[model samples]
Target: MDSFLSALKISLWVATSSTLLVALFGLALAFVLARCNFRGKNIIDAVVTIPMVLPPTVVGYYLMVLLGREGIVGAPLYQLTGWSFLFTWQGAVIAAFIVSLPLMVRVARSAIESVDEDLIRVSYSLGKSKWETFVHVILPLARSGIMAGVVLAFARGLGEFGATLMIAGNIPGRTSTLSLSIYSAFQAGDDTRAGQLAWVLTGISVFVVYLAGKLSRSRWM
Candidate 1:
């Protein structure tokens, strides 16, 4: 139980912080995506969502290639900071955040697009700056949708498996998250540990589904 609790807490921490970062980046991207026109908007959209459509292992492999100490970006990044983002808790967070980013972006973009154009026009006519319009008129109206997106992102991040494994490996009490820990338990022929972890994950899944349903219902209302 203590092991379970420790893994759970660490997993939640990774999920929460990763989701926050994903939401922040996704929101910024969605804001521009919702309001601006550019030549590569479609390209950008596809790129942002590619992770969702790709197999988890494929994404993980890609992350491993790109983030490994000998890889392109990883080499310089490691040299500059003496930081190893490949096999650490931070790597797990990076994996989770990358995997969950699409969820937040898709939801936030949809929400921002749903905002009444007339309200934006009115604000513009009133000589309000774009930032002011976003702050006063757009954000408040879209908060619920964004919040739902955030929750979904966090849940998805918490459930991340393949990408995390490739990047962080399965080091108990360090890089291992709940999903990876569960996987390790099964691989080690420890059915009891796996079963316990499975129940915990199941509960988390059920709660996230319920929360998402509530958010959707409220949106309809």
Candidate 2:
């Protein structure tokens, strides 16, 4: 019981920080998808969104293969700084980020797609640079969508389990987040502990979606 309580705060911290970065990257990608024209854009969009439909375990395994100490990408990353990612809290965050990324990109793309094209054209005609138009014109209009994406990403990150397990493992007081904690309790036949963690996860997921709704709604009035 005390152990479970002890781990809850750690779970929150991992989820919060990881979701922040995931949403940032996702929003950036969404903007590129929404407004940019280039060859193979549709293909790029499909590739980015593939994870949303794939099994979380598969994603975790892929992340592990790339992020492992001896794996191609992971080897170079670790060698460059002697820092390891496997089974760490940061690794858990990476798993959560991947799991939530598709949703974030989707919402952000929707947000940017919903913007008025004429306004962008007007801005261009007025001699505003692309970066300036993005900052002053496009982003302001897409704020609600981006906020919605962030909330969704956070909610998704909160519920991450399979990938986090595969990549981060279930080490408590380290990488065991709320969902991982619940799974641990269940696996150990501690139904009571699992139930409590379940409630916590559910409550947090609901709150995050509610926050998303509020942010989207506030933009209208």
Q: By TM-score, how accurate is candidate 1?
A: 0.94
The clash count for each model shown is 0, 0
Candidate that would win on TM-score: 1
Candidate 1, superposed: residue stretches over 4 Å from native = 219-221
lDDT by residue for model 2 (53-164), tens: 8999989889978998887789999989998788888888888888888888998788888889999999999999989998898789888878888888888887888888
Stretches of candidate 2 off by over 4 Å are 79-82
The per-residue C-alpha lDDT of model 1 at residue 54 equals: 94
Best by lDDT: 1
| True-structure lDDT of candidate 2 | 0.84
lDDT of 1 by residue, 125-205 (tens): 999999999999898788778877888998999999988888888877787789988988999999999998989898997
Q: What is the lDDT of residue 205 in candidate 2?
A: 85
Error of 1 at 83 (Å): 2.4
lDDT of 1 at 68: 81
Worst 10 residues of 1 by lDDT: 212-221
